[model samples]
Target: MIEEIQEQVAYYNARSQEYDEWFYRIGRYDRGLELNQCWFNEVDVLKSALQDIGEVNSILELACGTGIWTQELLKIGKEITALDASSEMIAINRKKLNDTKIVSYHQVDLFSWQPSKQYDLVFFSFWLSHVPPTQVDDFLAKVYRAVRPSGRVFIIDSCFEPSSTAKDHFFENENEIHQRRKLNNGQEYQIFKIYYQPNVLIDKLTQVGFQASVKQTNNYFIYAEGKKINKL
Candidate 1:
């Protein structure tokens, strides 16, 4: 499993350049632009999840590829620790931000990287999908330990439950993508799958001792919220 995960990370790291080009080649500068727009459209849903958070003093964003939320957190005056498993992505983030004081970028595996201090808020945007369901319990426990009492956790992900639209989009056919990649050594590769469901993720979070809930809309990705319970 570890090897599989590492392989995925290394594959992504190797594609940062091509991925960057692909993102803009078709006039979609941000691959997540649609997702971000959907998020803003449903910002109220996110705000409700974060209502208890009075002031976000310190934040940790896991799998913060290219500082998407990093910019938003900085705009709100929160100190951020942005981390990702891909060094190439981190390099892109660093170059984009120019090593600003408010943003600290780290290249580390989320599962093994231990936090030096607890944070006021912990967020994972479009990250849980990359994690296989079996390891979710351990990941949640780590996240619960990383937040202070009353701290909140936010996650934005996709639903595994099939939708009519998604079915037509990708599920309706298996040969949705036919593009192939050939490495310099002549090895060939193709993307398999890159999506997940909300219920599976929420159940895993609850099993790990969190109070989790989900919010869904046509405009955005599935939104899940959990709060760390204070020990009595």
Candidate 2:
């Protein structure tokens, strides 16, 4: 399991250059006119949800990949702490943001990384799904501690829709938690790719003492909002 996790990191490091293609719906991810449009429409929904949260003084972004969502978080966060396991991904994020003084970049595996301080908001996009099932409780527990009292934690992750991924990648049974992802060069790597229903995610959040709600956009994305329960 540890070795496969390392492979997952290597895959992302190698894929850093082409990672935007998936978000842009270019290359193998292009699914023709209607489906591609639908994908963008749902993406817009997620964007609006983030904007609706308004602004915060500090934010912590986990698995901050390639600055795709970091750019969005920038609009609402005055100070952002971005962390990722892949140095290559962090490099791209820094370059894309032009090493903005408002953002602090750190390269660390999510499982091993600890929060040095809490923040007004905790955000991650397309990240929760990558967490293995066994580690999810521990993962969300980390998210819980990363937020301040009544602070918000927002999540954006993928649904199990086939069209949401590259055409070359195949979806296994819904019950399975692993998937094989292929880079453009035809190199494939196995990684934990767990999909979640809205209710299930909400339950997970609530179990960790968050007052949470989750919603989905048709067949593409599941986004969630949770507030750390104020015990004080």
Provide the RMSD of all predictions against the true structure, rounded to 1 decimal. 5.6, 1.0
Best-fitting candidate, measured by lDDT?
A: 2
lDDT of 2 by residue, 96-157 (tens): 99999999998888988888899999999888887878889999998899999989999999
Per-candidate TM-scores read 0.72, 0.97
User: Which candidate gets the maximum TM-score versus the true structure?
Assistant: 2
**Can you write out model 1's per-residue Cα lDDT over 1-232, one digit (the tens) per residue?**
6666666676667766555443232222233556445445665565454554456888888998876556656654368888898888888877778778888878888868777778878888767766655666787788888888877788876433332121122343322322234433344444323354567657777776678787775644577778777765
Flag clash pairs in model 2.
none
Candidate 2 has a TM-score of: 0.97
Worst 10 residues of 2 by lDDT: 169-178
lDDT of candidate 1?
A: 0.64
The 10-residue segment of model 1 with minimum total lDDT is 161-170
- lDDT scores for all predictions? 0.64, 0.91
Quote model 1's TM-score: 0.72
Off by over 4 Å in 1: 18-54, 160-196
